[model samples]
Structure formats: structure tokens, C-alpha cells
Target: MDLLSIKDPSFLKKLSIKDLELLSKDIRKFLIENLSITGGHIGPNLGVVELTIALHRCFNSPKDKILWDVGHQSYVHKILTGRASHFSTLRKYKGLCGFPKRGESEHDVWETGHSSTSLSAAMGMAIARDLKKEKSFIVPVIGDGALTGGMALEALNHIGHEKKDMIVVLNDNEMSIAPNVGALHNVLGRLRTAGKYQWAKDELEMLLKRIPAVGGRVAATAERIKDSLKYLLVSGIFFEELGFTYLGPVDGHNLENLIENLNYAKKTEGPVLLHVITKKGKGYKPAESDKVGTWHGTGPYKIETGVIIKPENTAPAWSSLVSETVRRLAREDERIVAITPAMPVGSKLEGFASEFPDRMYDVGIAEQHAATVAAGLATQHMKPFLAIYSTFLQRAYDQVVHDICRQNLNVFIGIDRAGLVGADGETHQGVFDIAFLRHIPNIVLMMPKDENEGQHMVYTAIKYDDGPIAMRFPRGNGYGVPMDKELKEIPIGTWEILREGEDAAILTFGTTIPMAMEAASELEALGYSVRVINARFIKPLDEEMLTQLFEEKIPVLTIEEAVLHGGFGSSILEFAHSHQYFETVIDCLGIPDQFIEHGGVNELLCDIGLTSEKVVEKVLTLTREKQKRV
Candidate 1:
């Protein structure tokens, strides 16, 4: 049943286009059944089945590297490359990853999670191949929507000038995670409509060919005429002028056409751009109609109906809270413009978009451009809230530092998925933002305890027009805390002490606050009094609270769901060193130096000794050791 594990590689080579078509059907059906049982990317994988089959048929994998951009559409590639049996365990614990992992298979040349990095990577591989005098085709399969990224454009410029023998396959489905945004999407829309003009030109060529000796001369002249006509139909001066030999508006669903075009590109010389048009969800009717990107990444769903099976009694998700809160704020303040790099559905910004369409921007996986654009908007005094995942925000770190923080721009960066995102694993963990952002000057970074506090933090970020601020919030459901009706503007750089104890002070932020409370309760049972402080603002450091805790001779403990290096506790250590107060022992609790693997959040937390029971044990051990010394 699994084509991947078929021992005879010659079987794939012998398969006709008709056989491949049938195989595509089998792959689609298999993907549907497996993904329906175990939640994963259904729409993109189903759409790319034929395209992947055609590519592997034409190109030799492990020799000719086919780099998949973002790796979301790599399920078909995986299914074809000795991983079909693993599809049953997709996105589960100790199962096949949703994205392409290099260690998983030899065919997967690169690991990708975030968008728009493929072009640069492809270029690097191409240049490396050239340097080594190795004959391998470097093909980067990028989505039409991924072209909107500034980095992709930059890479295009370099690759165009280098004139390297690389293939850039533009898989144009007219959608990213959501329907694409900006001028690029508009340009693609016109280019997609140029099918009629292309047909006319093809007919004109056949007419010119009938002129015998003059046919060859007339065909060349007719090609120029077609080029002129192409300009008339839709202007793609973007790709054509970039020195890439533009080919196709080929049907990606058609195996014959895909194989032919791929073979054509393989035989061709330097820098080919093969544009293939595809449907997001080719076979599935329910997913095909989903324009909101709900089918992009999913949990277990009903195959008969397109209904997502949600567990009852789940709290309101943090993403929904942010989107709704932003919408409410925007209703009052017209200057509040919401921005996401590409994710509208993932970030739950559809509610805000529906209410204020013009004010919302889905920048199409261009985080750097979004940051700089927000900076530009801030110069004009517009309140631009750049909502992006913490991991994705890393892509635009330089832009944030140079364009935003340096200018002290009033951009509110609403960082979603701020903690451990389970299942997606190390590539997607949102644990590095605090460590990175804390070092940056003139930027205020804040975190919320729950959904209610997160809403208030949003209110705070929008109202504060002095400088750039980022509010980091975790993934999944909130702590069932009721949201406040009125927005409260808390003072900047302030923290609140929830409980009082002189023996030990527990400083924690965001989702870890509840864990700190639990740990403190356990410590109290062990006859050790513990103090709990909600360290709200990470950047500002709550200096007054720090000074008070230090003066009280209490042993300080910092807990955050971020990296231990250059993070919350590191700041405390830095403060202590500066003030010459090293006597008070401060222990940092967080993700270790090594990369954490995929699992449930709770499982990972306990494994890393961040659980309340572990914390309680550690505290008791430390206290007893201190007592013995006394």
C-alpha cells in the first residue's frame, strides 16, 4: 500500500502518467484517512500530491536537492520518499513531524518551519554545489504567496545576478496561510488571468510555423510579439526583469503537464522559474471552499463533514482573546491598525479583519517588511500593532532593533505563541523571545498572567505611544479567568506581589505564574514561607521590587518558560553583580541549553524539572542546605 517502501526504485520510473494519476489518487485518499485520524496539514498536502509525484519522477532525490519552502506542503514528498507508513503517526508524540526534518529522511535536504527562508537556502546550496564542482540541480519550491517576502525578493536579486543553474518553482495556489496580501498578490492575480493571452500567442506561433523557411524567423519575431502581448495582459516585470527565464502557468494537478514542465526545466540551462498553478484542496470539497485557512493546520476532524472535533469545556484561546481585544480597541481608536506576517486565521485576526478590513494587514510571511512598515506607520503617529508568533518574530530581529527600537517607534508587537508550542517541536518553540528582546535597548517587553491580564496588556500597549512595546502571550487556552469589561492602563515597568514570605521570593511571568503559585503552596506545606511576585514587565525588570527582595535577605528564584541563557534570571544576576549583592542566591528555572523535543506542554515541562513538585523538592533541598550551613 505504501509506495515509499517499494524496494524496486525502477517501479516508479516504469510508471506511466496514467499510473502516476492513479497513484496520486491513492496518496490523496491515504493522506485524508491518516490526517482525519491524526491531525495535521490536510489541504496543502492533498493539493501537492501530483506535483510532488511529478517532481520525484523527473528529479533524482538525495542528488538533485528539491528544497520545500516552509515545509508545510512536504507531506506528499514524504509519502513518496520512504515515509508513507509513518503518515499514520503524523504530528503525534514520537511520530512523523508535520514539517520536513533533515534527520527524518535523506530526501529532505533542508528543515524549514517559518516561511520565505527557502530562496536564500536554495541559493546557498546552489553556490556550494558550484564551488564543489558537483552536478546537482538545486530546486526551491516556493509558494506564490511566499514571494511577497522582502528576503525572497533579495535572494531573487542575488540569484538572478549569479545566473546559477537553479530552478525556482513558483507553486501559485493564490493563497498563503490566508489569501495573500499587498501588491505582489495583486500582480499574481493578473498573471494568473494571462492564460487567455498565452493561448492566443500559442495559436499565433502555430500560424507563423506554417510559413516554411520564414517560419523559424517568424516564430522568433512572434515570440517578441507574445512578450509585448504578455505585458499587455499582466505585467510581471518583477520575475522577468530579475533575469530568471520564466516558464509556465502549468496545471500542477495534471501529472503529464507537471512532469513535462519539470523535465523541460531539468534540460534547460540557467536560472529557470517554473510557475505552476494548483488548488489548495484539490480533491476534498469541504477544504477547497475554506478561504479562511482553517484547513491549513488542523486537529482531528470528521471526514464526512468538515467539522473540527473540539473538546468541550476548553477555555478561550489566547489568540482569540488578542484578536477580539484588538477589535474592541480599534472600534474606539481609529489609529489602531492590526498586522500579521502571514497568519490571520492562526493569529485569530479574522474577527478584527471583519470589523475593520482596511485597518488590518496580512503581510504574507514577510516579518521584516511588517516590522519596518510598522516603523514607517509609527513615524506618522499611527498605532500599528504588529501581531506575530514569537518564533516568526526572530526573522525580523534586525529590523526591530534597527528600524523600530533605535527610533523609539510606537509599534505594539503582539507576540502570539510566546511559550512552548507542543508537537511542532524545537523549530517552533517560542522560548527565545525574552532572551533576545531583553538585550535590546529602548524597547519595553511585557507578559500577561492570563487572558484577562493579556487583554489589559493590549489596552496598555495601544495607549502607550511613547516607544515600542511587545506583549508576549502563550499558545492554547487561557486559565479560565474572566475578562474585564473596562480596559485598565497599568503603569509601565511595574510588578505586583501576590503573596508575602520573607524566606524566599519567587519571581515569575506569564503562564508560569500559576505554576509559581502551586510551587509556593507546596513549599509552604514543607514549612518554608515563600513570596510570589508577578514579574509583568521583563524589559523594565521591576527594579523597586528587586531592590526590596534583595534588602529583605530572601533567596530569590526566577522562573520563566523561556531559555535560561540571557533570560529573566540572567537579568537578575546582572543586577546583583552591578550592585555588589551576590550573597542572595538566585536560581533560574527554564528550558535547558539543549533543544527540547516534541511532546505535550505538561510532559515537556515536567521532563525539564519545571513542574511544581520538582520546584518544591528543589526549594526544600536548598533550604535544608542553607539551614545546615547556619
Candidate 2:
């Protein structure tokens, strides 16, 4: 019963159903208590406790690969695989990861953070297993919401065509982050209540047997009619048509039912879709009652009252500032519309949706479609604001280039969580947006120094009719800066001078601005007059200011909270080389060429040498080089 001492899931196979049920309760209690302190995907993990136990009991994990889609619900899997002892350090700096990691344990066969990837990964592993003549099951536990993704659908088609021997556990909880939408969700809804279809089929077979005295022609016709009736009555026939043996709308929480259905799926030939119905946040009332998906992922909360523990009197969240600004602008401009890829809650677009439901659209996890939809709106002279996270925007890169950028449409992209999202780790980090979006033509990229400027930038982006423009903001709260009564447009290709000095210039924007200022002040104390420039516009380099720096022969140091390669700093280097400023001393500071792991934003920055100390050192080095050349 001591969950912390659990070494592996081998003990699960020996336990009786009653013992397993008790263990499931213990697991839930452990998760509720531990995650309340550490904070995690509580609802998802709670939902999967019994199912995960059933899985471990049914299959040998390290041998039989159990790939988890999105990996958020892997906490139970982690605990069973001897990771319960690491709960205290979950999502902390260089500690236990929030998602499945290949290095964490051999049981974690595949690492994933994004949704709808497990099916494809499972297919590949299944193929490899067949090639090597290995005898182990390939199970990919996918959510109903994830099943709607374009990638998942594509995988479903391919796996069905190939008829690979794998068990596809369709975890139907009727939610994915937010309440699921679209036609597939509707079909699953019908299937959830189709338990009587099996009984109907049996009765039909008995009635057919009673007509044995009929001619062969009539018997064959009756058989055909019964088959047609089966298709009409059974909701899982859709998957059956795709070459999969359809089983269950089994109760996921019931260990006996789960074990029975899982065993059936394992024994079935070719691909089998085992539809298991589950309740999201099964044991916890607060999470169970959650309708809008607020409890899907959460911060630390009180176990007694379920009240989220939050810092008091903090600045507005960056998402709220941006979304509210867009909402405010939408009141004045009828042409302005908002779109998100099933992130209405995360993007903080509820205000806009409440005010103008017709103008707000949640496209339901289809990033590619959302991008092209925005482009389509832009082509019709409608100003569409595509609100998306930096990491997810990677899914729509082609749409951004081909539809929005190539057509030169006026699309406003609000890139939220633009840099170093703390808890979600490498897969969810927003560091690569600058590199990915910078090289795309007809796209103007910028980040604001503070929330006040952020609102202004939002205005500027919506008003810019030339082409696609994006304003990226960080994950957490904005700096509590004063607000202006009216929003105004900032000129494109311009940088703001925060401080003036003669020794060197520090160019940076967004979350890195404060560090640059601190570094400059520290340098001033040491008798180095370092100028600080807010390089707000990442694309279309500030030609006038850059030329002034080159003419003055000021050594330059660029800082960014993004990848160093093909980022803002790289753009600066390209500018200097193109402008015949070959002799200018330049240095750059940013995230190194590696995937930053799970940690606090500050800690990750420190690890990569993007802190003020690094900035000061770089400034000292660049100025010293300039002095040596002089």
C-alpha cells in the first residue's frame, strides 16, 4: 500500500481484482496528495488510474510498448514504473519531467508531449517489431480529442489498410483539454450509448435461425439483411469498415471490465480498436465536475477545498492583456475576428467569444486549418487574428508560408507563450518561433518590452495592411506597467532607445529587455557606458539605428530568449554583413543549440548563459575587442 516504495508493475500481475482495486484507490490518493503540492495534469492522471493498472496487469510494459498520446496522463504509468519517489521534483529544474521521457525508464518506450502522435509512433514500432520477428503487443492509448487530429486520422487510415497486429486503446472521456468538437466526437457520443447493439445482433441471429425451412435464396437474402442491420445498429462498424476488429465501450474504471476488454484486444488478429469509456477526473469532485477544462492541467491546489493557490495582486497574465486588447479592438472594428486551434481557455479568448461569438472561432486542434482559415478571412478583407501558442504554431508552418505569407494577406498572429514556458518542458517550449518565422517572407515579427507596449503592438499588428504580422508574448504575467488611455500604432522597422552610451549597444526585446537593462546598469557602475536598444521588430531591421551604430563604431551585443541560430541575433549579424559593416565588433547571447529541458524560465536562461551576467560579460568582451582594433 506504500505507493512511494513501488519499484515496478510486476507486482500488479499477481494481485487479484480486489487487490488491484485497492491499489487503484491508493494510486489516486497518492496522486491527489502529491500533485496538489507539485501541480500537474491531475484530471487526466486521475482518469487513467484504473485503466493504467489494468494495462500493467495485462501486458508486460518494457517488452510490450504502451505509447501514451500527449503523455500528460503518464503520471500513473510513471508511478507504477518506480517514479513515485520523484514526485516532489516533478517539473522542477533538472528533476522529474512532466511528460514521458525515454531516459527516465525503460518502461517509457516512447517520449511525447504533443497530442495525436502515439498512433504514428506505435505504427512505426509495430512495423519494426514485425521486421525483427519480435512477439510483443504495440498499444497506443489515444484520447477521443486526439483522434480528431489530422495526423491521427492519417495513421488510422494507414494502420487499418496494413492491418498491423496492435491494440489501439481509444480512451473516450469526451474531452481533450477543452470540450471536444466536430463530427468524430459526435460519432463517439453515439457509440458511448450503443451497448444495446450487441443484444440486437444476437436477437437478429436467433430470428434468422428460426427461419431454417425457407429456401436457400431467401436464407441468403435474410443473411444480407441481417448484415445491413448490423451496420446500421453498431456504431463501431465505422472502425470495422476500416479493417479493425471493434470491441467495447467498456468501463475504464472497472478493473474487471478493463482487464477483460484488454485481454480480448490483445488476442484479436490484426488491428483492434478497444473503445474504453472513462470519466475525466473520476475520483476528485472538483476536477470531475469541470466542464470547460480548467482542471485539465493545474497549479498547486488545496486538497480540502480544491481552491487553486495563486499569487495575490499580480500583474495581468500576458494572455489576458493580449486577448482583452484584441477584444477591445474588435468592438471598434467590425472586420476584426479571432481564431484559435481549440485553445479558447488557454488563449484567454472567452471575453472576446462572450462579446462577439460570431466573430470568435475555436477550430478544435487543427492548427493547419486554423492558419489557412485566417488566411482565407484575410483574403476576403476581414482582419483575422490567429491566436496560438509558439510551440503549436510549428504545426502550421507551411500554411503560414504558403497561404498567409505568400499571398501577402493582412493577418494578425498573436503568438502566446513565445519563450521559455517553465513547467511544460522542452516539447512545450516556445523558443523556436523566432527561428521558424523569421525566414518566412512577407511576415513581420516583433515582441514588446512590456504590457503597455504589447497592447500598442497588438494595435499595430491589426492595423498593418501590408502583410502578415505577429506579436509574441511570454507565458506568465506581464510587468505591472502604466497603461495609456489610447492604443497607437508603432512604426515598423524601428527600435526604441531605452538608454544611451558610447562604449557599446545592447539590442534586445520582450522578456530579455529587463536583463539587458540590468547588465547595462552594472556595466555603467564599472565605468562602461553601454547603450540599450529595444529591438522590438525582429524582421525588417532598424536600418537607421543600425547605420548610426555602425557610423559611431559602437560595439554591439544582441540578446534574445530564443534559439541562437536563425534568430534575431542571427538577423543582426546578417544585417551587419550586408551593410559593409564587416569590421564592427559583435557578439550574441541566447539559448544554446540544444533542447532546453524542464526547469524554471530563469534557471533555463541561466543554464544557457542568457542572464544579465552573461550579457555584461559579452558587452565587456565586445568592447574590449573594439578597443584592441582601435
Candidate 3:
């Protein structure tokens, strides 16, 4: 079967279970092959092949409203819905999105890249469907790991209470990104292994009746015994207590089982939680064996060997450098503790976990709790390093402001992937951290130029006991700069002058520093003396340097890889205005007011006019405009 010929899921209703099984195999093979050339969430998609097939077949999509939580596992859904031909260009520049995009197809009703948002969205849809008096089955397929998120739990509570007509598929792969944590995961584990627990509960009740009760009152006190037995013998008593009709821990790979359960769930009233057990990386050997989430999302790989392709890399990855540095410092600093929200693998914190097992915490998918936990640790005089992706930290903004910033705690926040992450698109990009965090009171935000400076800044953040401080590091490898033998602390709120000039200045930091340097050289060749400054401290503007530049009346250009509005460039603009240096001709350049899509980092930068050529052009214009002012 040519998967590219698939137009929509309507044809699926005509197929038999055996045909669907064959289709699942074909889909798996297609994903494994296509994803080898163009990397994606292969492991997750493979796991959901049968499950997705059953979903589209059992319920009508675009009408019945099937929603994928996180949307990475929607590749099979995409294949069933006429996007297989675009798999070659998947995650490329102007290509098929890595996640569901509403603009791409009518089938993609909701666009999601972040996890644990599906249930809430599904609830909203369900409410709307009822308001309009429309009849449709609302199904939201959420993973077991995402079930641990506070938002997911809150949605479950609300959805269960509301008693909406929906099927909540709990896709239990036993892990999310990394191996799951929390008591909820343990509950799913028991449910996954023991499905006959309800039967055992009935037998236990019969046995309990035969036993003696206090004061021969079996009716009154035995109910308490039944309550205890609910936890012990009822596999899905958790969801049942939450007002949901619990279904089987069905084998997600079995097409017949999945279709049967889904069909039954659709007919059942209120909220039906269909617990489906599936393995992550179901068919592939290497991906299935990946316990550290290496195959969760990946770059290109060799299909025959199952080996991930890579360029020759001498530089350490930013996450590894930051986490390893934290691990190194943890050995000497007993008070230091590390924390992450379901991202130990991505943040490269395995070494830290191994060395300081007692001090390391992986709060499962709960970013809000992770932020406040660090604040709690800081109150007792313990240095806590909260390692979280910039995108995920957005979910915990209130905790950051209310708990961490308000108390003025010594919490060092290592904001991983703090720039335009290319393939994951707008949802995963870390561009908004500076804009979001800089305005918060008593919070210091900064980005380092290279790996060496990053380590020093990490040291600076850990040692600085003033208030909450955060260091931003990009997604991929560093610039391979030589690290210092002894770690040192950079002065707080100070900027580094990379090159000095009189005509014009380029103020930038982190990943954009090299581009600024390149532009400076280009301007110099054209006879314009361009100054380059590493304006690393985003919150605290280099006021002394700004004052000097303003007094000299040098035209300036602010370059950032972040959003221009309310970003580092805006900070510089606010400084010029507040200080009343309105004469300083400042030009801001960065990601314009729009969502950047999936593409190569360089491609995205070029499209957004953040390249060196743009830099040179902007600087030349600023210099020429300044001369005209004179």
C-alpha cells in the first residue's frame, strides 16, 4: 500500500482488522524509513501506529473530534489524513510541521507542541459542541507521563466532574521524554501489569464478610475496609474515584482490542478513560531499548544500523556543559541541589543524578511545582538549580514571580534551549524567556557568549546570593572555546566589549555575538568603525557603557535572536528613553512580530533578517543616518 495515496481517514471505516494491522505495519515501516532521512518523533509515532489507526477507524475525525496530546505522536494520524506525500519535507524549512498545525489541514483542529494541554482543550471543545447541540465524540489521547502534570490532573478533575461525553485515551508508554516519576506513574504501573485487580477486590470483599469485624458491625466498618481495598485491589480505582468510567488497560498495539474499547467508550456516557498500554518505540529495536529518551525526538539516522548521524563535534553540547558544570560544583557545595520537570535527559542531568542522587529531583511534568520547589529549597539556605527548558518555564511564570522572585531567593535557573530551536518550531523555541523574565522584579537574566563564559555565568549564578538569577544557553553545541582551568564569577550586570569603535556599535549576546562580530568586520572593510558589545545582562542594561556611547553620540544597533518587542532590543530602547538620551540613533533588529515556523536555524535566522548581512546593512544604515544627523 502506498501511504502517499491516503486522502483521509474515511476509507478506514471500510477496512477490516487484518487490513488495519497490515496498514499499521506499513505505517511503521514508512515512518522508520522516512524519519531516517528526516528526523522526527519516531519512537512515539511508532508506538501509536495501531492506536492511531484504531482511533480514526473507531471514531470519525474532523467530525467526532480526535485530539492528540503533545501532537508529536500524530505522524500516523497525518499519514492517515493525506500528509504522507509531504513526509520527505517534514520539519524542513516551509515543510510539514513536526506537530499538528491548524493551517495545514482541516483535520488538525488544535495545534500543540507542549505536553499535557490536550485534555483541557478537549474539554473546551466538548463544552462548545454541547452548547451548539452538536453530536460528536470528543476523544483526547494523552500519555501516562503527561497525566502527572498538574494541569492534566486539574483537567481530569474538571472533566470528570463536568461529566462530558468524551473518551479520554490514556496512552501509557510508562515514560515521557525520560522515565516517569511520581505516585501516579506507580498507579499506572500497577494497572498496566494487573488487570484482574477488580476481580480480586470482589473476592476480598467476600473473604472480608467471613472475617470478624469490630463489635460484629461488618456493614459500618467494612466500608472502610472496602475503601482500603479500592487502592489495593482495584487497578483503575484512581480514575473511578474521579467520576470517570474506567475501561481496560487495553493493548494499544492490538488493533482489535483498541477498536473494541474505543467503540465501547464512544457509546458509554460521561467521561470514559480508556487506559491503553503501549510500548515506546514499539517495533524498532534501538529506539525501543532507549531508556534515556534519545529516540523521543532525533536528528537523521542510518536506517540499517539504527545509528544517529552527526557532524564531527568537538564542542560540548550546551546542556551537557551546563549540567556537568552543575554536577562538578555539586561535589564541593553540599548545599547545592538540582531539579528539573520531566527533562533530566534533555537537560543532560544524568551525571548530576548519579553523583548527587540525594540532591537531584525530577518532578514529573510539573513545571509549576518544580519552580516553587526550588524556591522552597532556597528558603532553608540551600542552593537550588532549576534546570528547565525556556518554553516549559513559561508554564511556571506565576511561581517564578510569586515564589522565587518575590522571596528574593538564591535560586539559580539554568534556562536550557534559550533561542530559536529550529525543527520543533515556534512552540519549542526559547525566544520569549528574556522578554518574560526581565520585567519581573528582583530577577537577573543573562546569556553567555560561548561555553567558557556560560560555565562562568553558571558559577556566577550559583555564587550570587542576592536574588533569583537565570542563565540562558542555546539548544545545540557551543563554539568549542577553551574552558577555564578554574571557574570564576563575572561581575553582575556588566557587559563585555568585544571590539571598540567610534562610528557605530552592535549590542548583542549569546548565539548572535559571532554574527555581530562578523558584521563588525564587514563594516570595517567598508570604512565604518563598528563597535561590538556583548550585552549579556539582559535585565540590567550596561548603563555606564550606554552613557558613554550616548555622550559620544554614536549610532547603535541592537541585535537579538529573540522577539524584538519587549526583548533585549526593547530594553535598550527603554534605557535610551528613560536616561533621556533620545539623540542616540538606535535600530532594533530580531524576529519580527510573527510566529517563526519549522526550519533550519540558519534558514530561520536568514528569513527573520538576523543574519550577518542584515546586521551589516542595518549598521551601515544607522551610521549613514547618524552622519546625516550631524
Output the number of the lDDT-best candidate.
2
lDDT of 2: 0.91
TM-score of 2: 0.97
lDDT of 2 by residue, 424-511 (tens): 9999999999999999999999999999999999999988999999999999898889999899999998999999999999999999
User: Model 2: C-alpha RMSD to truth?
Assistant: 2.0
For model 1, the stretches where C-alpha displacement exceeds 4 angstroms are 7-10, 196-237
CA lDDT, every model vs. true structure: 0.85, 0.91, 0.90
Q: Which ten residues in a row have the lowest lDDT in candidate 3?
A: 196-205
lDDT of 1 by residue, 1-630 (tens): 556575322356779878888988888888788888787888888778888888888888879898999588998888778778777777666778888889888888988887777999999999899999999898899997788888788999999998889989999988888888788888777777666343465566688789878988877787586677667654564676787767777888988888877887887777988888999988988789989788987888999998987767467899998888889989899999988888988899888998899998887878888899999999999999898999999999999999999999999998999989987888888999998999998999999988888889989999997899999999988878776788999899999999888778889989898888998998888788999999999989889878878877667788989999999989999999998776777787888997776667888897888888867766666666556656
| Winner by TM-score | 2
In the range 1-630, model 3's lDDT, one tens digit per residue, is: 889899999999999988988998899899999999999999998999999999889888899888889689989989999999999999999999989999998889888888899999999999999999999988899998898988899999999999998899999998899999999999888788767443355567777667765435665677687678767766558898998877778898999888877877777889989899999998999999989899999989998888999888999999999999988888899999999999999999999999889999999999999999999999999999999999999999999999999999989999999889999998988888888898999999999999999999999988999999999999999988888989999998899899989898889999999899998998899998888999999878778988988898899899888888889989888888988998889999888888888899999998888899989998888878888888
**Cα deviation of 465, candidate 1, in Å:** 3.2
Q: TM-score for each prediction?
A: 0.94, 0.97, 0.95
Q: In model 1, where is the ten-residue run with the lowest total lDDT? A: 1-10
What would you estimate as the lDDT of candidate 1? 0.85
Model 3: lDDT equals 0.90
